[model samples]
Target: MSTPLKRPYRRRNVAKLLARLHPKGITEPFAGGRSTAPERETALDIAGALGAAGQAGPAQRLAIHVLCLRWWPGLFEGPSRVVGYRSVAPTAPPPSMSRSMRCVAPCTPKPALARVPVERPAETAAFRALADLIGSRLAIRIERDRAAQDADLIRHLAAWVHGDARPNTSAAKGVADECLHDDLAARVLAPTFLASWARAVIAEYRNPNHCPSCHGYGERLQLTAVAGSRARVDVASCDHCIGQGVMPWSKKRRAQQLVIGEHPFRQYLNAYHEGALALLRELEHRGAILLLRHLGSDLAMDTE
Candidate 1:
């Protein structure tokens, strides 16, 4: 009978070890097996992750890119809208898990050590910042685009301020109220605030949820290897989020969090509809002035 080949056994061993392969971003239980790249992320890292997560379309992506550039223009080089990351130093294993692990018996080719990207404060902030910028940009873009196409808002403004106050003389003190109305609407850019509801609407469009860590869900899947004689995949509670699902950026939880949430910037989102309608009615100015005032407080004025 032909003898069993030594190469085959070595190859089989390699295959077994690889069967339990854990790539970056995947949760593993080893104490220090995590990758350290995420500890100090450049802007490119955050943008790359965001691009990979998949936003709705180009406009949404542009909105987010602009927002990031606005917030931290110098954090990274290159366009935020694309995934071309600035060259980073080669990844090194974490201190505790730095020992080289390899198949003892020779195989055709050995498996390279896996690299895990750790999510640190800066990277987490980038994700949260991108989400906020995208949401706000979407709101303003849609509202203003729609308003630009419709003239009713301008007409109403003119109607409310229909005539100009005459100086009790022959000269027309102001252009016909219609002209003045269109001018005001143009100045306020159709007063996107009316679509103040657009903030929440666009947010919902993006399927905005709660905790960044778990996408608002409170638990994450923990993958464990079977202990004794066999290799099997088992599910366990995620110790990272403490099963709370939300990963907060703070002193205790320092490693880059895999989960995403809105805990950092949700307060910045504006919901005009939630405000008292009576307050809007109390404005003494004509429709044009009142509309402009409403839009002045917005963080999202230009949609381009």
Candidate 2:
């Protein structure tokens, strides 16, 4: 075919074309690097050079198609000689866009002794939800309670019941007190809900909540932060002496400090007696640790 006539660069399309094709490939156009004007200008310059040379054919058609698609992907694709441009080799096969399957090893089996025991429908739900939540949130496995003796429906149900129920209060004292073993008391005192106050207290005792910053863990905490900052990056100071690292109450011994005046209970109460009493009563009814904490302060004051 005779050298194709050179075509004028459409100033309007120059930018549009450059946007569609530059740095020449299927990569995304510069998100923020070079401005659209410069890219379009470059594209126009290239187009002008091409027209001067001659109309592009099969191979050249492919190049033009690629360049065009690079910028304006909306353009149609087909084999044909239109204007002075030719289509590239049939259409190269579309790139594979399939993603590979993710590989995850199956969980290891748990020992009979380490499994969690749960019984009853509610318990079963709790165990399953706990297990799944632990796996997702804590990135850890919570084995079935090991004490479960069977795998049958009855057995699984029993296991769920056991798992859902709170550990007996006797568990803390170690020896089961026959005198204190009234079934009514046990039922009344048993913890009832997940994330309940009882559960929070138990969890704190089991693992103790820790500060992500400064490795401080437990009830007492010292907080440290830059003076001007709103504590975005503050770290927990050692719970002792507000970051002194020496626990002020430690020297006095928690028991000794419990003697009322030795601690803040009486002083706090004298200053806010009704409020303190109301809070204490509320906390006691809730079975929270407030009694132990406040009673200690009260007794310490007496000793002083």
Candidate 3:
């Protein structure tokens, strides 16, 4: 019989196959049997894990890309499959889970207040400071875009207000009113300065009202997360207000005055609404962030 052909070297075989398989050769090093390049690893890991978990979706993939790219430069460096993340198969519930899990209630968060009431002195003071800080930050951020003479002034004010050089806590105490409103208007050219001015004007002029829905007690309409499904929501009436839209109050005459609804307060309401819209615009432009942006809750302004 003819002698058997000499077997190829194991290393040579691997090298040849790898060369053909990866014409560019191994550009990135391997880590724990996987490629070290984050883009490659993430593409594989996300596809595998999400596919296995059965939650993969176009939006999820895009979200993952957005999330990963914040820290992982490799992910957004070059074009890759993740760029077409939408093309992945539509996600569906995993086949392995029991039916009970599928029918489980969606998860949700419980609402804190049963009813919302008029703003208190302490709360209003906090709000004013926060609004000022936001307006100042926006003013500074916008100053870079235009060559306004007030740009430097805006930058200085923003830095002092937002940075560690802010007004002393002792000085800020009892100085919470719109005392600085004129200062902001005079020194800052940013759009939020107008918003701050409007807020100050509203605070000065608006007649405070207890929330019609929550009553002045600041409690109305309880909200609780669904038992299991976090995404679902459940709402109930405030036990204190009893859903009647009124709460116990000793100042019956003042409450009646509020119910009578004076016109000046109405003007304040309109102005504050405009101010809110302006603040929202500032957020849209990425100049500032509202508390709701961080907590994902509206507890701060439950009065409306």
Candidate 4:
């Protein structure tokens, strides 16, 4: 069979969007990259335009699908804090489209995370929703998938609850606490809904590389120009920052994180200490000494 025809560079809007969203140079996808919102929104808008123009092709379909965020951003957006994007192969390419290149996100301008938290409208809204869900008769069930996330979420949630439920309270707790709470509902969600806040915490603590630039995986996307036959999308890695996630330092920016005592993570952990101690005490109260051996080893090994 003959290969599919490639769009000419003059009309390669999808190609441009793909490149903008793809990693460039030698870095990775990051959440706060300057072009992230613009590129993503443009892709969706252009894809819609293509569909309206009656463009029928696999390339258009794949492009549109990639840009379409899940309908319920509020649901998964929370837990995704601890859990990064699931590793799914890029949506299968159309038979007509041949792979050409891959690049990280460095080509796009990145904002400095010097002393403030970036405003993520979608995530902020979700946290607000969670605050409301916590105390009312309303219920929203979400899963906590990983062990590390479980611990992290608990810490952030503890800070969130105690911070009086204000929006963008990262300065106080290193977590966004923008929720309207019901005391009973909060007690119900402490263990389960905590994962979503992990992302908020990460946004605050990310090092320079993972700072306002990365797509959270330490890389970005780059698109190769549409050439003779096919254009390619590449994923690139950040050479500046070695970490895959959060960091405690940033040499490039000459900025240092707040000391442990003043930092949000420290406060968040402290907030959770109360819940932890209470749970341990309750376990001790029940005389479940055998179970306490492993779980209660931290506060003390008093398995009596």
Candidate 5:
């Protein structure tokens, strides 16, 4: 029978130290575990350190990143696959069981509203400050070739916007195919395109007719009774606006505001409104992807 080999004395000592340090087993020390409290505290410390080092933008980003990681860990992982499918046939519930499910009427989704882009200097400054944070902490670098291609594509798009804003019939089969088909490109350039689109919309269209009660604020403050027999001020959606800051204007009013005939105004408004809605939808859809990309870049830098 072969004798069992024992671990070296030095190795045993190191293992003992690690076991003492961890309390539990030292296997996969760096792997994700159930101890989220420590992670939260560590994240707070990192944010504080970054802030103290005069990296406010990075600190803010790190805080946001930590919050996202806590709330939506699945965002960093792959899509879940359905392991099995259920039977198509429906079964009757138990006789003793009470069915509490109610039939709810389906409602149409409201159309997105077109709005003027209000210039915010403070926001712009903060955005610029994030450039350094992204560059240094995230370590996201675009290749020269890729950067050039993007610039060229942006120039082409800008030229098209400056022109009659018509799709090239020779190249594109239809407006939908031309605009909505390129998902990756749309996601990558959503921010830039949305900014330009907003500016154009503001310049071309009239200001939205704001709600009278809320005065463009979607919510209102109301006093409500609490469990302690005390009233507290709570912010709620404005009843008059139905949570939308802007109210829909009549055709006549819209046409008068645009200083154009109703027929022409309708056609123009529809085109612009549809485009705005599409861009907004694209941004909303791709927002998570962008956040993940940034977070991944930051993590990659740290790992390196």
Candidate 6:
């Protein structure tokens, strides 16, 4: 009798056997096993756990997506392409034209960390809208003149929550100034009075010595052009005084002021700087929270 024929082992059967033996090891074999599905599922789980589901709308979804992007940016990667090939062959010319050029195939380009084209525009719009909404809710006027600064504040807030750098101090100070000015205006503080008050406070703390170049005037006039009968003059702030009209007070002078200071006097002088900083910190902290809330609501409305 002829010998029985034996079946050959195949990769498919081996893979299936492994998958059965260790179900968790292979998610899906021979089906482009690497996928973003797990990443998406994890994102959804995070969102749900963070109270982002249920009544959450498009704005909320968008905000969640933004957070997801920050965490797992690879999930949003676009279809990759091979831009160009590189030569792996020797630098010397081939012996014959018929010889094949030994070239290495190009790798699929990775998405740039800073470039998320599809969602960036929408993300920007969301931030701006959040800024505006937060401003409105907080009773802070988003003036057209300072719109750019306000937008920057919103961007900073977004960066902060996403584990990036904090907001710029100058930007925060600017916003604080605007808020203070608005509050004073609402109380019907006269502009001239406000200016005089600021000048008085500054003068009290400033060194008694005036800037010699400007002689107590912040600006100095310079002859710009000479015509036949008339001369053009331009006024510029004195570089030495930096437009303050007085020299900066020394540490010794500050100590002397403290020695003469009563409790009220100390508080008054400290308020000039400390009060503004405190206001800025509060605004930034509260604004960040409100912005995220508004972003979710807006995103939900958009989806509907």
Q: Model 1 misses residue 181 by how many Å?
A: 16
Residues 134-231, candidate 2: write the lDDT tens digits.
Answer: 22321111112111212233443454578975544443333222112344323322334212322222222223223433232222333456568644
Q: Which of the two candidates, 2 or 5, achieves a greater TM-score against the reference? A: 5
- For each candidate, what TM-score against the reference? 0.19, 0.15, 0.17, 0.20, 0.25, 0.20
- Candidates, ranked, TM-score: 5, 4, 6, 1, 3, 2
**Model 2, TM vs. native:** 0.15
List lDDT for all candidates, in order.
Answer: 0.33, 0.30, 0.35, 0.34, 0.39, 0.40
The better-scoring model by TM-score among 1 and 2 is: 1
- Tens-place lDDT per residue, model 6, 1-304, is 5322221111112222223223454335211244343321232333343354313566544444333222223334454555545434345543442223333423433333332223221224443343333333223322442466567667767776787886576766665554434543343234443333333322342224667887654567777767687876666778888864556544344435434234423432333423322333243333323333433422223222
The candidate scoring highest on lDDT is 6
Which 10 residues in a row give candidate 5 its minimum summed lDDT?
7-16
Model 1 quality (TM-score): 0.19
The window of 10 residues in a row where model 4 has the poorest summed lDDT is 251-260
Runs with alpha carbons beyond 4 Å of true place in candidate 4: 1-202, 205-240, 243-304
Model 3: lDDT of residue 101: 63
| The candidate that achieves the highest TM-score relative to the unseen native structure | 5
What TM-score does prediction 6 earn? 0.20
TM accuracy, model 5: 0.25
How many clashes show up per model? 8, 34, 18, 34, 0, 5
* Candidate 5 lDDT over residue span 95-114, tens digit each: 34234432242343334444
- Answer with 2 or 6, whichever has the higher TM-score: 6
For 164-252, candidate 3 gives per-residue lDDT tens digits of 57645443332333122344334445454445543443332222333456443233334466667664333445565554333322333
Identify the runs in model 2 with alpha carbons over 4 angstroms from their true place: 1-17, 20-43, 50-56, 77-304
